[model samples]
Structures are given as structure tokens and as C-alpha cells.
Target: MERDLSRQELTAETLVLWEKTRMSLRNCIKRVMRSHGVEDHKVWGTVHAYAFEIVKLLGTIDALIDHVTKGSSTREMHPWVRNPLRVATYEMKWRDLKPAIATSEAVRIISERVGDGPARFANAVLYDVEEVTLEEVLEKAEDEIERLSIEYSHPTWYVKHLLDLLGRDELIELMKANNEEPVRYLRVNAHLKDPDAVILALEREGVVVEEDPHVPLILRVVEWNVPPVRTEPYRRGWVTYQDKASAAAAYALAPEPGERVLDACSAPGNKAAYVYAYTCGEVELTCVDINPRRIEEMKRNFKRWGVEAEVVRADAARLKGVLNGGFDAALVDPPCSSSGSYNRTPEAKWTVKWRHVRRYAEGQLRILRGVADLKPGRMVYSTCSVTVPENEDVVHRFLSHEDTYSTRKPDVPVGSPGFDRWMDRRYRHHRHMIRLWPHRHMTEGFCVTLLEGG
Candidate 1:
């Protein structure tokens, strides 16, 4: 044998470059689900083998496209036959591949970009999805929360409002921790570096990270071989990619040094550059945002976190005459229905529902009643959102129409308190709110509170 036909012509030219890189990830998830309706697995983050095969097909590739279109309505197909039959039913049910090589590579990418009558209707619906298997292709959902929304592809009215706010054993351990894959916190730019020299330069670039006996100088990559944004202690800033509950809401909105804060929806400014890098640039912040391109991406994230502040664009929920009343503290962080970061933005749990969380808790209670005219002797009101009509019913209707505001409790050190029977109220300073909890503090679902003013 001539070297077994030259190793079968190099395995058919490596399956023609893995079927043209899996049809360019099904046309980049059908052009980000047809221009941002969802499906942006953050552009498969630098292709870690297609980011571990598209985040382990989170929410199970829309439950393997409603079990290969059996229950129809992928808005009646045709994003070139619904994103190449959702990438050939996620490579024949979660990468087991070989359903005749995922229906002949989605009919050779719909006969090279749609032709031959949509490649014979994507080869007659992937030849009836390669004769179903992944648990005999179920999902004819009709109840039991649309069969746990096609068994956890989510969005059956968000599993019937998380089965009435988490009751089926913590909504089945928060829907199996929102379908796994997530755990990569880090924040030690300890006011410009030195948490033991940024953990010995992120373990000489292999990135191990760990320290976090409750948030300060955060860190928790726990294990990595690379991709702490291709480390170098995240390029000399010593570290940043935040989310230890958004750096414990900038150390529980401490923001001191010559005060005068007010972040109020500051875009791209992660907690206003972690409150001017934990007040070293000495707060007098400002930042606001009604988008002048997110105030130029919060002035390029306060010049890449060196952090100085004062960007402003206006309309922090109608800051009467684009602000004037002075401040000593305020954070706000409006916009909600993130549903506690849907386990790392899982296409924001099918683009957030419940009328977008009652229009994002009525625009976060009109930016908490227009930032209480900055009579802000401190205010926080965060929200990655774990819902309670967008966190404690928009912080109990902004402390029942600001009786000069109230609630306090946030000495940080981890969270979970608010939600003292929400939905027919019963809050008594909902233990001064904090709430975190992606299945208890692997954290992502967030909600802070802390107010004062009077």
C-alpha cells in the first residue's frame, strides 16, 4: 500500500479544513443571531478550539435547535436554513459528530452559501436530523414549564419564572449553574499592582491565581494555561478582567478621597474603573452616560484603568438639566434584566424577557428617582440582576419614593440577603441588600443596594 494512500490523502485534507472551520462557525452564529438579537458567544473568545466548542453548546445549542426542528418555528427556518441547521445540530448532538459527518457538513454549507434549493432544504432537514439520538430527540414540550424549557435550553418564560423564584431545589441548582463553563475572576491591580507582585507575575504566565477570602484585591482564575487575556499580568496593569461580584461593587462603594462620586450608568467604566482604582486616583469621579458612544467608552475605560474620571454624557435617567446638585457618593449601575448575568451572558437568557424585566425595572426606577438630586451621602444600587422584578422590586420602589433614602448594610465580605419574600413585598431593609449568588458565590448574579442621603 503506498503508505495507505498517503494516509488517505492527509485525512481528506483534514476534512477540508474541518469543513471550512465548521462553516465559519455557522456564519458566525448567523451573523450574531441576525444582528444582535443574541447568540454572541463573545465571538468564541479567541478560538480556544472554538471556545471549547462554543461554550459547550451552552443552553444546549438552543436545545439542539428544538430537537432538530421537530417542534418547528425557528421562526420558520431560513438564515440559510436556520444557521445551517444550527451547525448541523451542534455537530450531531453535542459534537459526537458523524451523523454522516454532520449531514455531509450541512450539505456542504448549503451547497456553498445557499443554492440548489437551499441545498434541498438543508438536505431535507439534515435528513431528519440524522435519525435522532441525543436521548432520542425529545421536546414536544407543552407543560411542566414547557418541559423545563426543552429540558434546560431555557426561556420557557425563563423556566416559568425560575419555577416561581427557585423552588424546585434551587431551580435545579440554578439550572445546573447555568450550564457550567464559567469561573475566571481577577482584579488585583491593587491600586496599580503588587498583590505579591501580582501573584508572581501571574505564575510566570501560566496563570494560577486564587486569593479571595472575601473579595479584596481579588483573584480566582484558579487554573489556566493561558488566556487571562493572554497574560503578562494582563499587560502591566497588574490585572483587571473583573467580576468578583464586580469587584465587590468596588469594595462596597467605599469611594472616599475627596468624594463627589456619581457613576450612574457609566458605560464601559467597570464600576467607574473600580472607583478610581479603589480611591487611589482619589475619587471626584463623574462618568454618567446616555451614550455619546458610551461617553467614548467611558473615556476608554478611564484610560485603561489608570482611572481619573469625569466623562459625563447626561440622562442618568433624566438628571434634571444634565446634573448640577453636588454629590459625595453615588454609583447606580442601572440597566437590568441581566438575570444575574445569565451565567456569563448566556445570550442574556434568550434576550431577557418579562417585557424586558418590566422595562428594566422601569428604567431602574427612573435612575433611582433621578439620582436623588445628588443629595447623595452615598448610594450604590447595583444589578447584574437575579431578578426580584429586577432586584428587590427596584430596591423597594426606590425606598418607597425616597423618604430621603435609607437602607445600608454592605460591609462586603460576600453576600446573599435581599429577597426577603419579594412579590407581595416584605422587606424590612431586606437585610440591607447584597445578593450575589451564581449558585452561591461562584458569583455573577449580583445586586447591591446601600443608600443613605439624609
Candidate 2:
């Protein structure tokens, strides 16, 4: 008979594998580019199962560190010993695991990888770590930022940033939404089949689906007997997994039949695919990405969705020399901090810093300026971000500089309006922009700003 390895043992081993194999979640844009197929299949499978557990740990890791070390700096401990203690603390506080078991397991791993001295320190810390609970910490939170950070499993700055834009209740609501698991939204391929037929087919496959009332082609998977990817509709290219917010972007862009559309920054191609889906494959699209690998990836994505696009390798930030700009409508899904998407990609939640928002905002603005092209009519400036620096702030600064363009409200509007004053910047047509809250929409948080040539 084989012994069932304890959670602590599994967690310790997982941490070792993670330290070696995990991808950088510093921001959203780069994470999508890297091919993250782990060679060690066993480690891969085990680590994925504990992803939520890891996320739960991240929210409270610092607090646990503080408590364990008698409010001393965690920087003093070696990372090898410190990490296992984080996992052990998470298991003990959140997972209902015993303190002795969690502490013992952590000590065992630290002793093996680090040294006896550090392991002894780990042992003492974890004993104190076991005393700290998420509720207990929340009960004694110093301020709103501290409370929301611990409660939602997000960084303190992230919670602090939103407070100015939202009230205490609203901020808490948004954070709560970010911490929960997201629904898998799939876009029905209207070009291939009818909406009812696709829903029926998915239902027959033991996949419970609910179509979005606002967007005809988008469906929300309520339950799944088999994974949506394994379903026949997905395999046949009759439906593809996409966010409702992305599908909303396609509708907002509203490319006409025989219109020329440029999907700038279209790698991983969800928005690009939706352009074709919404246009019923009638529009001519030029899918652009700077990276050669991303260009290849976009090609594959277009093929998978039966999406026809003129895939091109071009730097979005500077496109003057590469190609002449005479695009009718450009779907500029430019890079942002991916603030809205951190909930789904929890790794990014930990890695994201306040500084990233401004950097991403600059990059997004530069790409927007390039994609503005000579013959622009309406360009959709969209991001999977709710932050001001990435969303409204970028649009605010761009509209000020670009004299030819003005704020144009996206059609198919059913969302909260963008803020007039966020921190310091006050947008002119703030109400014209749309901000989709995940808590309200049950979709990935998105900000879609449209610019039209005068």
C-alpha cells in the first residue's frame, strides 16, 4: 500500500519545483508570450492543483512573515527556508491543517535544502505563524488598504490605488471579485453556425451554458461535464473561449462588411478572432505583433478560429517605416498592466507593482499613436485593465496630444462610465468611456475607449 503524502510534504515539494520552473507574472503582456510547458509533467500537474492555494498564500505571505519573525524583517531569512514556511503558514491558517504538521514539514524541507540553523528559525516562526488567521489579521487591520489587501489577496498598492476612484464598499466589492474564480466565456462562431444550434450542441455535450443577453455571440459556461476545450464545438471551431469584455470590444468596434480592420498588438488573438466572428468573416484584417514568435502564435490562433487575417510582424510602438497607415478602423488592443485580468491570472496579482501601471500606460499610448495611422476613422483603444494610468489616464493624455482625434463613445453601451476625476487627472468625456466591473458583469474587468477622427 502506498502512503498518502501529507499536504505539507506536497506543498514543500511544490515550492521547490515552483522556484525552479515558474514563469514571471510581473506583468500580463510578457507572460502570454513565453511558452510555459514544463518538462517535468509530474511537477506541472501537482503545481497547477495548488494554484489557488498558492494565491491564497500570496495575499497573506507578508503578514505571516511579519508575525512569524516577531515583527522583524523576513529579508533576514534565506529564501529556501522562508518559502516553505510561507506555504506551511498558508496550510495551517487557511486549509485547516494542524500547526505541528505544517511546522514539522517546513522544518524538514528547510533542514534538507538550507541548514539546521535556518530550519530551527523556520520552526519557531511557523509556530507563531499558526497563531495568525486571516480573520484575526483582518480584525486588527490598521486601515482600509491593509484590510482589502489581506481580504482580497491582492497587493496593498493595488487596493490603495482603487480607493480614490471607488468608495469603501465599491473597492471591497471589486477586490472580492478579483479574488474569486472567473467564469469561462466562449464566443459562438456566428460565421460557422447559428447561436441556438451552438448552445444546443454545447448542452448536449453536458456543458451548461448561458448566452449573454447584451452580446448575442457570447456564452457563459455554468457547468461542464468535460472541459470546454475538449467539447466538439471548440474542436470544430464553432465556438472559441473568449472573455465577454473582449467580445464587447468587437461589438464596440463594429467593423462593417468589407471594412479594413487592423488588430494591433493581436498576439494570443482573442480580440482579433472576435473581429472576424462579429464581422461574420466579411472584414479584411491585418493582425500585427512586434515579436516573430507572437506573429506565429497569432497565425495559429487565426487558423484555430477559422479567422482570416493578414498576419504581419510589425512593432506597434513604431509602425511608420514598416507599413503605411491607411487603416479604416484599427482595433488597438495595446499592452497594459492587465490590472483587470489579475483575478484570473493570480500570479500577476503578486508580481504587479504600482510602477508597472505608468510604464504600461506609456507603452499603450505610444502604440496608440503609431496605430493612429493617416486614414483613421474610428479606433478602439482597449485594455484588460481598470487602472487609471493604463485606461482613462492614457486616453486622457492621448486625446490632449492628438488634435485630429476626439473621444467617441463605443456603441453597445451597458456599463459604468469612466471617472471624471481619478487621483489627479480629470477626463473631459469621462462619461463617454465605459468601465466594466467584474463584480457587476461577471466578466473580466475591461476599459474600452474609442477615438474618432474629426
Clashes of each: 1, 0
The root-mean-square deviation over C-alpha atoms between each candidate and the true structure, in angstroms, is 18.1, 4.0
Candidate 2 shows a clash count of 0
lDDT of 2 at 172: 81
- Report the backbone clash tally of model 1: 1
Give the alpha carbon lDDT tens digit for every residue of 1-454 in model 2.
5344444445555554444556543221122112243345454444454545565447667666675476676556666776687777776766778888878888887887788998898888887776666677677779878877877778888788888778779888887777777878999878888888999999999999998888768999999988788788989888988888878876788788888888889898888778787778998888889889777877887777788878888788787777666778888888777788866766667556888878888899899888885456888888888888888888888888888998878876567888888766678878888888888888888988888892
Best by lDDT: 2
* Model 1 per-residue lDDT tens digits across residues 400-442: 8778878889899788787677557777877888888788788
For model 2, state the Cα shift of residue 16 in Å.
5.7
TM-score: which candidate is best? Answer: 2
